[model samples]
Structures are given as C-alpha cells and as structure tokens.
Target: MPVMPSSAPSVEKGPTLRNDSFSDRRDSVNKLETGCLSIIVLGASGDLAKKKTFPALFNLYRQGFLQSSGVHIFGYARTKISDDELRARIRGYLVHGKGGPPHTHSEDVSKFLQLIKYVSGSYDAEDRFRLLDKEISKHEISKNIQEGSSQRLFYLALPPLVYPTVCKMIRRFCMNKYNHGGWTRIVVEKPFGKDLESAEKLSTQLGDLFDESQLYRIDHYLGKELVQNLLVLRFANRFFLPLWNRDNIDNIQIVFREDFGTEGRGGYFDEYGIIRDIFQNHLLQVLCLVAMEKPVSLRPEHIRDEKVKVLQSVLPIKSEEVVLGQYEGYRDDPTVPDSSNTPTFATVVLRIDNERWEGVPFILKAGKALNSRKAEIRVQFKDVPGDIFRCKRQGRNEFVIRLQPSEAMYMKLTVKQPGLEMSTILSELDLSYGQRYQGVTIPEAYERLILDTIRGDQQHFVRRDELKAAWEIFTPLLHRIDDGELKPLPYKPGSRGPVEADVLLSKAGYRQTHGYVWISPSL
Candidate 1:
C-alpha cells in the first residue's frame, strides 16, 4: 500500500490557492501531469470492458501517452474462464464492433496480453471478494515494493444493480485495509442511477467508504476532443464570445441523432427509456459544457460547479414542449418483443433562465433510427433585423460544431459572389479535422476517458450535484411518460422523426438543424 506522501498537501484545509506571490499549492504536488502513470482496470471481461474500455486503453498506450514498462492490468469478473477464453472474447468485440481497434501486430498483442490477468467469482458473495482482495495484495507485495507503495484502481463496468454490492464489498474488504498505506480509486460508469433519489443514494453509499475525490463518475461524451474544444472555442476566442448571448444568438441546438434502432440488447434498452438512456447522461452533459459559466479556475470541483449551475438553471420542461418517439420493431428483428416498453427516439425543448440566455431556448433533439447519424451543435445567430444586404439575397449566419465521422468547426455566412457579381450567397468557412490535420488519428471517446482516469483528472467526470441536477431536469417528463400522459409519435425506420418533432421546432420559429440542408443553398 502506497500512502500519501508526507509532503502531500493536507486535505482538511482543502486545495491551496495558487498565486504569483505565494508558493506552489499542495494540490499541485501529486496532481497528475500529461504522461506518468499505470492504470489497473477491474471488470475487464465484460462488454464495455472489452469493446470500448480495452481499445481505448490500447489507443492511449499506442499513442505513447501511457508508459509501456511500468503499467499493469488485471481483469476481474464472475465467469470462470481461462486466459485464452478471456482474450478470445475480448478479441471478438475489438475486431468487429464500432470504434474497435485492429487485431494486428502479434508482438504488440502478446505484450498487452501479458499485462492482462483474469479472476472469477460471484460478485454478490463476500468470500469471493475476500479471495479477490487477497489476490490483489499478493500481486502488489510480490512486485517488491517495500511494505507499502501500491496504488490500485477499480472500474465498475457492471450495471447499476450490481454496483452497490461491488462497492460495499470493496469497501469492507479491499479498500479499508489499504486506505492508510496506499490509495484506491474507483471509477463508475453512467446512467449513474435511474432517477434522482437513486443517484443520490448511490453517491452517499459510495462516499461512505471513499472520499469525493476518489470516486470518479464517468461520462464518456466529455472525452471527445471536439467536446473539450468547446471551452476553447467559446472562452479562448474573443471573436465569437460577444455574440454568444441572447441579443445576437436566436437559439442553440445540440443534437445527437442516430439512424439505427436498438439492435438486440432489448433487456437493457427497455429498462432505460429515451429520457434516462441518452438525454439525461449524454445530451445534458453536452449542453452543460456549452452553457456553463466560465469556471473560476481549472480545478475539477470549480469546473463541475459551473456545469451544475447550468443544469440547475435549466427550467422544468413542460409536457407540451417535448416529444417522444418509439421505433416499432419488425418481424425480422426478433429481439424487440411486441410489448417492449423502450422508446427509440426523443426530443426535449429545454430552457435556461439565466441572464445570458433568458429568452433563448436550447433545444436538444436526439434519437435512434433517424434519417441520418449526426452529432453536432448549431448556434443560429439572430437574423439581421434591417439588413442592408437583404436585397442582395442574404441569409442567417450560423455556427456549427460537428462531432462525428469528422470532427470540425464551421460557420455559415453570406459571402460575396466571386464572378464580379454583387449578389450575396451563403458559403461555409469550414475547418474540418480531415482537411486540416492530415494523418492524425483522433482517438475514440473511451480511449481518452480511460487515460484521463489513469492521470486522475476529474474535469471530464460527472459530479454528484450535477448528476442530481440532470435527473431533476428530466424527472417531470419521466413522470409524464410513466403516468401514460405522454405518448410517443411514431416515426418510420428511415425518416428523420415524427411530424410532431417538426412541430416542436416550428412552433418556436426554428427548424431542425439538419446538416445537408444547413449546407445546401436554397433553390
């Protein structure tokens, strides 16, 4: 067990404030820099553990951000499988799933295989947990680190039901013994809980054993580089900051549209409908990153504070302003039963009552089985009221930040025609990732998130208050859906969505921010 260095800052007083006149703060001491650590992933045999989790870790390692020599990995799960079976199961997902890495390089694959070791046990049984703890301790001691000097991380890749059991077992047997000598950090996956109360209870239960800092709430959306660039795009650049308010901007739309229905996994999909499934965890987080007030500092808590404020500011959505859609299943897809309770699509007309966005609506329209797969943010600047260029065929100025297939920033404004004509036409000032940074492989979301956890940066992780705030914003709609008051509009398999979705936007005098139409000139 590696204890916090005596030189480590005192936690009772909180992080020290940094200043020019004062010496460096204590929090800055063990604060992880860009590249210096090894990560141990628990539950490395599960679906997420293999398809997303391992590939992400491997990408970071391949990119040279993770140290190849000192790093270690261990996979813990219930299924009693041999090492070859575990590797084969992981390989199936890696070579075949979306965003999975290639299965090349026998030498490199062997090296990574050497890092992985699996242990099997029933998660609910205490004796199994005791055995697992003993295994971890023996491995750490055998590494030849004096009497202590071991740091461990446990990632909960399991679902919400098993989380409490896992947490309690770790606390009672695994973490308590290592608390004083070494640090143990636990990273939890989201849909933190099904509702606000559940989220709070889980946090409280976890916090009983681990301090707030030790518990990292993962939201993989924040791992994308484009998502992180949002801060830089808004705050760092003075060009667009002035026009970001209600005065110049008409409305902001954050969309996460998908074209495919729930392919199998009906059990998980039906339990968590559209509201709890995507909007609460992913879409809301994106909205917060865009709408949050500038943090006082780059500290994790400080950044989370601003995000919470945005979530809190989001007004309770009325039943009329939102629309839910369910893509009915076909006879071919046997997984989706006729009586399935899951929603395949959803749209929320959210509002923030803060001064900067008092009247402007922030619409979040996301769904599966839509016309196309798109994820982007559109900021429609207020139309020029009495534009001098109106006679010259002008259009609204819009800024778009795209985060899929290609990561890029683009602005649509009317530019003068090049053929010696004075007529104004809309053209795009595009900064596509493909065009600008050639040959640079932008990492997948999971890869970046896994690396960040190893580095101990909580900026991308969700906070407890933020989680509650997100659930609060969606609770009313959830209630409406539960009480049979809210009905989903039926949309076709290949269409954009139901007609009600169009009405939801049209009533507000805005249109759905479709990419192709937003790009093409009006005939």
Candidate 2:
C-alpha cells in the first residue's frame, strides 16, 4: 500500500474558516501557470468518447474553465476520420442549454469543435503514439509554449483489453520528456479488472509505468452532487452524527435500478455480470461513504484512508446471503450467447464487523429493466421504541439521499394529523434539489470528474488500495457463482427483480416503503 500524507488542516474550528482556507488554496493552485494543456481523448470514435467525454470537454470550454488559447483537444482512435466528421459525430450529444434543444452546428458548437483535432492510430503501435506526440508538440510550438511548461492529459475511453498496450505505447513515445514543468496524467474508466488478481496485476503494471499521483481511476458516481454532499450531511450536521451507526440505524440500502435493458449490447455485459458492473464499484463506493468514519480532514487521501478501513472491516459475503437474477429476454439478444448464465440483477448483504456498524446490514441491490429507474441511498432508522401514542404500527423514521434522475435528500418522520382526531401519519421533510435549485443546471457526472482531473483532486476517484479491498470482498463470491454454474432466477421485464431479492431483504430486516414510488420531476 502507498503511504498516506500527513493529516489535512483541521476543520473543527468552523465551516467559514475551513471554506476560506480551501478557497485560498484553490486560488493559489489555479493561479499557477501550467502552459498549453493538451487533452487527448483516446477511443475518440467510440460511444463513450462521443457521448460523454466530448460533451464534458465542450461544457468546460463553454464555461471558460478551459483556457481559449492555452488548451487544445485531440481525438485519437483506429478509425480513419476527418476533423469535421469527428466534430459532427459528437455535436448532437453536447448539452448547450437547459430545457431547450441542443445547439447542434451552432456558432458555439463550431467554436468548441475548432479546438479539437482527430488522428487515427493503432493502439499498440509505437509509431502511432510518436505521431500523436508530434501533433501535440506542434500545437504547443505554435502557441509559443516553452518545452518544459506544457501539460498533457490522456483519457482512455477504450476497452480494458487494450489498456496495457496503450499505456505502454504512451509511456514510451508520448510522455513529456522535456520535464514540461507540468504533469502527465491519465484518466481511466472502470471495471478496472474482472477480479482481485487481475486488478492487482493491472495495478502493478501501471505502477511500474507511472507514479500513483499521475493515475486516476474514475467512478462517475462519486461526482454526483448528492453523493458529494454525503460528507457534509454526515459530518456537518449534529442531527446525523449521533444516529449514523448501528445504535440508531436499523439497515441501509444502496440501490441502483435502470428501466431499460442492454438493448442488444450484451456482448460486454455478458462477460461481467451486474455484480461486477455495478455492485463492485459504484454501489460499494457509496457504501463506503455511508459507513466510513469521519476523515482526519477533507484531503483526498485522508478521506480515502477512512474508506479503506471501512471496506477492510466488511465480512466476506456468504453464499446464502446472495441473490442473482437474469432479466427475461436477456439471452434473446443477438449479442448474447444462448448458454450464457450472466446475471442482469444481483442483491447481496454486506456486514461490517467494526463496532460502529456491527449489527447493521448494508444491503446493496442493482438491476437493469426493473420496475423503476432510480439510484438512491436509503437509511432506515430503528422504529420509535416504547411509543406512547395510539399508533401501533408506525413507519420507521428514515432518511433518504437520492442520487439520480433527480437529486434530493429527505427525511421521513411521524407526526400528528392536523385535525383534532389526534391521529398519527407519516410525513417527509423534503429537500428536493429540483424544487430548491429552481432553474440552476446541475453538471453531469463526467463534467465534474473531468474538471477534478484537471485540478488534480483525487477525492472523487478510486485509489489502488481501495480497489484491491473492494475486489477482495467480492471476488470469492463471483468465482463461486461462476465455478458452481449458479443459474440465476429469471424475472420479467418492467417488474421488480426476482422474488428472492425481497426474501433476502426481509430476512435481513428491511421493509419496502408501503405506498411510496419516486416520480421523476421532469416526467
């Protein structure tokens, strides 16, 4: 494991003091001159690059975060394409306004596209990377950037299989050898590896090629506004500090559901099931935030250290505690093999053995083609024990942090009915972001993460040790399911996941909210 830095500056004084200190640091860092930043989007012709990466860059450019003349964008892939063609392909996905049609082919779009240039190349070939380096250097020289003053950022939007070869190629032929007084950074997308061993191997290989500070493994969930607010909600609020653990909390559910299926894109989904795709990285990361101890400070490494400790305390998942399912029509996809037993849904209970979370079950559930589309963290607090009121079966007081479709944090509490009947009813203290932030636009996950990379903040990115520990908790169960040829139960489209999931939650003491269904505000 890499050594952590000294504790971050103390925040116990007050929010004002901490905010001022952070702002000062940020201003100083942002003012430092790092000349001619070159952002290279590998796999530029692929869906991820066009749909997410380019759109994020365009938004940053539009907002004046990226320097107009000192920054350049490069699109690289194996497909032969012209600069105009590449720009045209990604223009439609770029978001230009709120509640309005995209500004496709407009003046702003054209201007943003002007900074982008395309280059076709093979992933493993040294000559291609050398050519890429030359293209980058040409831009720097034209801008009169000094040799040792420019920075380079490479975003790998490619498949995992090509990671090693591409990283090796970039290291050998593309890295800034002129010292660049600036940095070379690579942003990697996840499913970092299929399992623990492969993840460790990949880490080792990358470790040999680049320093840990230069590598960023991204999980987009961390960039969501509500997800980021988790820290403030827990540490800054005295209300939650006393009830965050096993003492007052009964159970916690971190759920992810999609209303749509793979849409014949099972070629990739079949290899790694929903567990690897969602539970292993995204949901688990959320769990860490929900359960981790307060960090020594807000520094990235300090926060990560607490997360690592929480993950380390989790007990191995028992076989009987897991439920896996395949949505109906999954195997019917042309890209999926007939005999494939890949799971499209999975729910597993993880128990942390540490004192704070000893008895509380942290249930993680995710599925595609489910009854609803939502991602949220639900904290069910223990029922008001020894009630003096006449309501015998009152609902459990719960706090929910919604992380998608809409962003909000609300608490469910029991209160008396307004009338003189002295009746009890469940009511919510809601803080829906849509209603609260009215016309303000929330930046997408990719936008925030990309900006973080530019600013060198690792707080929202995964560290190597955290990745390894996450795999350690899940790999054994994954191997067992594969080796045993565990046939997942089948569930119909547009329905909740398999019945087994409900049973699993019930056995672990979670009851669904009786009459509540989340309706998207836009809908």
lDDT of each: 0.71, 0.83
- The global Cα lDDT (0 to 1) of model 1 is 0.71
Specify the highest-TM-score model's number: 2
Query: Which stretches of candidate 2 lie above 4 Å from their native place?
Result: 1-34, 95-99, 516-523
For residues 205-286, could you state the per-residue lDDT of candidate 2 as single tens digits? 8888988788889999998988889999999999889888888999999999999999867998999989999999999999
Off by more than 4 A, model 1: 1-42, 65-69, 92-104, 146-148, 176-181, 330-341, 391-394, 511-523
Best by lDDT: 2
RMSD of each: 5.8, 5.1
